[model samples]
Target: MKQTMTNLKQLIRAGRGIVPAHTVIVNGNLVNVMTSEIYKADVAIYEDTIVAVGEVKDYIGEDTKVIDADNKYLVPGLIDGHIHSECSKLSITSFAKAVVPCGTTSMISDLDEYISVSGLEGLNEIFEEVKASPLKVFWGAPYKTPYTFPQSTVSYNFTKEVHENVQKWPECFGVWETVREAVTEEDENTLGAIVEASKNRLPVFGCAPMARGKELNGYLCSGVRLDHESYDHEEVVEKMRKGMHMLIRESSVTHFLKENIRAVTEVNPYLARRVSFCTDDVTATDVLEKGHLDNLVRLAIKEGVEPMTAIQMATINSAEAYRIDHLVGSISPGRIADILFVDDINTFNVEKVITNGKLVAENGRLSYELRAPKRSSVLTSQLKCKKTTKEDFEYKVDIKDGKAKVLSMNVKGPFVRKRRDVVLDVKDGIVQPDINKDVLMVSVLERFGRNGNKSLAFCSGWKLKKGAMASSAAPDDNNIIVMGADAEDMSIAVNHLIENGGGQVVVADGKVMEFLPLPVGGIASDLEPAEIARLENIINKAANELGCELPEPLMYMFFLPITAIPDYAITDVGPVDCIALDTFDPILELMEN
Candidate 1:
């Protein structure tokens, strides 16, 4: 209360010109997001809050720091409406360094993957890192863990008690994604979390991809008002018409923005008022080479969206979605002084970034040093599985030396999978993978050292002709998932991850070709973004050398274990028909155990 009163008094004095402002930006064309206007103006910042936005020569005293923008466009700092920092495989501090220079000042993250591995006890460790960094992190308390019931294994389940505790934390602003499948099925945890978020007056983010009519209605009745999983422009228009705040996602592998933005460019331009942008799950390689939300703005503008609307989508629209518009999303009085100077609105090239009234980055580089956090002991010891062997990944069949017909999970893409029936040669009671048929062996092993559970299934879309790829950064469960044509290479990949605590690895002919160490919680690395990107490029290169044609193979494989999406998924339990929400036998014929 005392701090608020003092701040109010200081703001009054600064605005009235009785006291000098800490910083002043002159001769700038301010991109007013709230009013959708760009006009020549000067901004006055008192401490870290904007005090005035018009002619501010009176506020420029002897101690005031003056910056000559020279008629550059002054825009608000970019905001990522939805992101998973853990998906970048970079620690909190490292992730900040990657995006802050790209003019990103804020990010709303659920941190669901990290919580699934470290549990609620490790929340404070992440918060400690968030405090020491320049980026502002808005956390969303996830509704549940594992993403599906009986489909995957996770160390911690998001109970009502956990939700109750996290909702009271200052960093937690709202409920994270409410899975459409879970809500429509009346999952107790999800429904109860929504109720608690409403009681606290917090927004409920949603996830409903490819839903329509009755299914979408049923999910919306649960009070989820925001969605980020629209697959096309029609889906985006349908959700926007139903009063859903749509977030057009353009991640490293998923390129939905080109199609989804058509909802505003071609269909209804007014619907963009409720639209925002997010990079749901991106890699370090994408962030280092391509700009963060700034890239999205450029794409939106090129797609025929007005420049102001594109900037608004990257800024104010997201802040309004989370009800934090009063604190950010615009360069208005009483808001934090996070402003960006760009010479070209069409290209969206960032020249200078002023966050909290301090110049932190310029010309795509951070001027000030960003120190990374020390590795925490709590997150470094997450991988606890035993060393795997060739026998662990075997898909045994009843036939002694004949061909066997089995059900295989065929990847249509990264998000959709279908059950494919294929015939494979049976050699000595083992169903051998057919490299000619593009049928490869895929398995998920429980890595928590609790159950040591392991399951096997066949996959075909990977197209790995000779080698194997494995990763512990799989979504929701964060378990070890390996896919390969040869069992020996599969074993080598899994054991390599186990030996290094956790990470992504590719092995060919029983030799590790590339590895990216995720020593923190077996999901994130403490290294800088450049180093992470270097390892990711080499890993993709190794996968390409092994005959995999998919772009971002490691990223595509990471989503295979998540049962929240549609069609089918494979976990440590077995192959699951996600639509039916049940496990199915891989063998088509009934066989004796």
Candidate 2:
């Protein structure tokens, strides 16, 4: 309270010109996101707060540093409504280094991966690291961990007590993405976490992907107010009409902005108010090759959206949705001095960036020195599972000398899989993946040593002619997920990850093709963003050369164990029918010998 009053006094004094501002930007067109207008103005900053935004000649002093904007457009720094910093495969500090220069001033994360891997203590270690970054990071205490109860294994679980304990932290903005099934079923832990967040006066973020009608209503009744998983424009419109804030996501694999933004461009322009932007899960290569939220804003403008509306979606709308508009989201007085100088609104080319009244990035590169904090030992890889063998991945059938019918998973796209029944010839009671049918064997191993549990299933759609790809960075649970046309290569890929702590590896002809070690928590790396991007590019290319055709194949395989999406998914719990929550035997029937 004392600091607030003192800061208010300083801002008032600086606005009056009695106390000179620390920094001043002269001759720039201010894009007023709140009013949807653009006008020429000068901005005066008192330390880290904007004190004035109109004519500020009087606020200039000999010691005040003045920046000539050269008649460029000044817009509020961008904000990502929802993102998983871990998906970038970089430390939080390194993630900031990649995004802060792209004009992303703030981000909100669920920290689900960190919590599942290292628990409450690891979450705090991440918070301590955030302090060293120029980017502002907010947290949402996850309602549950291991994503699915008893189905997926993890190092820690987000119980009711864990939710209550994390809610006491000032950094926790709300409960994060309560599982759709949990909310629909009125699960006690999910409801309890929501109640605790409500008691603290915080909003609950949602993860109801493809939810409609009564199910969506039930989720809303549980107090989930935000969503980033709307599949299309109709879903966005329905959720918006239901009073839920929709975050249009443009991730590496899942692209919904081009289709979802139509709720504003075609359906009802008024719905734009409830719309914002998020990067839910992005790779460092995407951030380096393309921009972050700024890229989304540009794509929206090109998709028939008004430039001002798109900018608003990336800034004020997200800030207001997260209840942090007063702190950021605008270039108005009394807000944090996070601003971007752009050449045009149509192209959204950010020429310079100022965060906290300091010049940080210029010409697409960070201009200031940034050093990430040392990682705690708790963040290292927790993979305690033994090396896998080829026999472990063998698909066994009761029939010894005949063809067997099996229910295999056929991946349709990035997130959807369908159960496909395929008849394969069996030899010695063992069925091998049929390369002629483009079917490959997939397996998930419990890497936490909680159980040396390993589940095997056959999958199609990777189109791998030979060899294998594997990683210990599997999502929802950081176990080991591997897929291959050859059992020997699959064994090599999985063993390589085990011997090197944890990483993504490609194997062909019994030789290691490419490997990217995720030494930090087995889900993130401590390397520079460019280096990570380089390794990811090479690894994906290696998988392509081995005959896998999907873009970002390693990333797609990483989510095979995630049970949140749709149709079919496989975890260490064996093959799961995602829609029905039922586990079934891979072998459907055996032919007469």
**How close is every model to the real structure, measured as TM-score?**
0.97, 0.97
lDDT of 1: 0.88
Error at 318, model 1, angstroms: 1.0
lDDT of 1 by residue, 134-160 (tens): 688889999888786464778788866
TM-score for candidate 2: 0.97
Please write out the lDDT profile of model 2 over residues 478-497, one tens digit for every residue. 78899999899999999998
lDDT accuracy of residue 423 in candidate 2? 88
- Which whole-number lDDT from 0 to 100 does residue 389 have in model 1? 83
lDDT of each: 0.88, 0.88
C-alpha RMSD of candidate 2:
1.7
Q: Cα-based RMSD of the predictions, in order? A: 1.8, 1.7
- Pairs that collide, model 1: none
TM-score of 1: 0.97
Off by over 4 Å in 2: 1-12, 15-18
